[model samples]
Target: MSEGLKRDYQLCEEIGRGRFGTVFRCFSPESGEFFACKSIDKRLLLDSIDRECLDKEAKIMQLVSGNPNVIQIIDVYEDDSYLHMVMDLCDSSDLYDRVSKRIFSETEAAAVMSPLMEAIEHCHRHGVAHRDIKPDNILFDGRNRLKLSDFGSADCFSDGRSMRGIVGTPYYVAPEVISGRDYNEKVDVWSAGVILYIMLAGIPPFYGESAADIFEAVLRANLRFPTRIFHSVSPAAKDLLRRMLCKDVSRRFSVEQVLRHPWITSGAEGRRDQ
Candidate 1:
């Protein structure tokens, strides 16, 4: 890698794009590791606050990127035109594509979520809140190792206080977030629950035709596990989802609780039994 925006990596193809940036498939000849280069146009960062958050995002990655399940910023470059970050390229695609297209078995979902919960716990311990924890952000590598990527909407809480402001995809927004109340990292639990629901049922627990409607549904939080969908799902899995998707923050499960949950542990025990 070079000192500035110029580097030895060759950006091969456009892999992903979002409002904040575009991701390109990149290759490094020296390391022989495929990476995804996320480039954010400077014009999109209209103010200093936006730029600060972008820099903070990079800092958060620097703090928690050591985890195997975390797709961290490998290297960064900035100039007048854009800010670019070379990140781990998870070749197996995202959870949205996996479970959204085809429902993974309840046991399979539990196994996948095991590493994810640990990764979230690791981030929380580092005081970084990955506010956005959706299926799209959950990725896997060529070997099917899970990773949680995309830190654009992530936040850091050093002083230990609830963050105020509605930020995150409406589909996965927590009820407190929709109600415009101060909320903590538990918002991520709701998002992870929603992803789990989608993984088990092949659909979002809350549904609507528009963004407003989706927000309303989230605020209501009427999570119904239809028999047609959840008939084959284990009772323990449903219980975990209910605890996670609970509207009351006090009642909702934390990342630690999720790791200790029976459903998750059962999968581990079963694997050992085998």
Candidate 2:
């Protein structure tokens, strides 16, 4: 632990762990409040790019911290061996957990997506593109409000500028990214579309036994709403999905457009009986 972090917060039991860091439930004695302390080992960031990405993670989070749908960072600390970030402690299961538990109705899916899109919209408006937007990165606070986190894969962009590099989780990556082409923030919309599809259908629109197969499916961008699974979903919902998952970037819906779509604007009122 960083000496500064050690003196500031009392670290508790491990609550989560990732490739290069571990998240612990910690208490800030001064504030007398709980927050998650994410400590990343400096040694693990072996390359310059790795360290740069780590730095961007905090910068990007701070840039978008104003949004209620995004996690708030309280403070950041770094020592010779580790970098620590103190953020709101959201102990509830992530969006992935909720999706795995059961399929959600169109209304329920909308409830989850409404905030997420807003968060993305806020990020885009600020020039950041969350290269990664999978369910695992979507967390909930004690109140169950969505809080997008984990900016290790996020980057900033300006109008007319496209981001390079192949980033994002396999199941939710946009086709342009897989194609090794320059892309824009619309990639986030594609990933969110995958999440929405899984929410209403309980399965990813693209999948395979291996990552390569999954990437192939993503590049193909063949979308479908199975009769059995989508028969009950509203046409407006399907239309939104089609526009969102469109392979042609020209035809894809922007975050603002998606927000205005009929299904979303209609309050996503769906039958629970489905």
Candidate 3:
């Protein structure tokens, strides 16, 4: 490690690891502040696209630094063998782990979704599309306020540019993404809708034995409400979900429209069974 990149921080156990890096819990000795240090191995940079993605992610984090609902990227530096990013340490489990334990009530769902919607809107306004908006990317603070994370697959929109790459997780990908059709910010909205569906229903709307099957299911399946399972779910909730999951990107509701939906704005009271 380079001396300039070295800092006096107590390195604790690993918090998480992904394809490109490992994250550790660390505490600053001088400030007595805890942080998550994500270190990406330099060896992974052999692939030019991977290196570009890393650079893009770092830049995107820098661009969105001031937003409270987005993860704060405190510092970035390169060591002799790795790139390290120091970030705000969020102690709460991701939305995925929480939903796997129990389904969220309408009020609980709203509380989580409200900040998430704001974060997405903020990113959209800045021309960044968080192509991957799954439950694992949504982290909670001690108060259960959500902060969006994982921008490795994010892309900035430019007119006349074709979004040709295969990105995003199969379960949360929009219909157009699965079909290999050009898409835009609407893809993120589709993923967000899937996240909301999982929050309330405790499972993804489309499921299959394999990735290809999942893609096929997503492209062909009708957006069906599990009325029998969620007997207490309000009609407005169902209506909003339907509009969001539309296969036609042109028909899908925008994030702003979703925020103004009767089910969301009226609060959970309107979503409770009468």
Q: In terms of lDDT, which candidate is strongest?
A: 2
- Tell me how candidate 2 scores on lDDT: 0.92
User: What residue pairs clash in candidate 1, if any at all?
Assistant: none
In angstroms, how far off is 211's CA in candidate 1? 1.5
By TM-score, the candidates rank as: 2, 3, 1
Clashes of 1: 0
Which ranges in model 2 have alpha carbons more than 4 Å from their true place? 270-273
Clashing pairs in 3: none
Tens digit of lDDT per residue, candidate 1, span 107-185? 7888788998988998998888898888888899888999888776788776877788888998888989889888999
Report the alpha-carbon TM-score of model 3 versus the true structure: 0.94
- Which lDDT tens digits does candidate 3 get at residues 114-225? 7888899888888888899998899987776678999999988856454756799999998888777778888888888888888888878998899998998899857777
List the candidate 3 regions with Cα displacement exceeding 4 Å: 158-162
lDDT of all predictions = 0.84, 0.92, 0.84
lDDT of 2 at 40: 95
- The number of the candidate with the highest TM-score is 2
Q: Per-residue lDDT for 4-82 in model 2, tens only?
A: 8889999999999998999999998999999999999989988999999999899998998899999999999998899
TM-score per model over all chains = 0.91, 0.96, 0.94
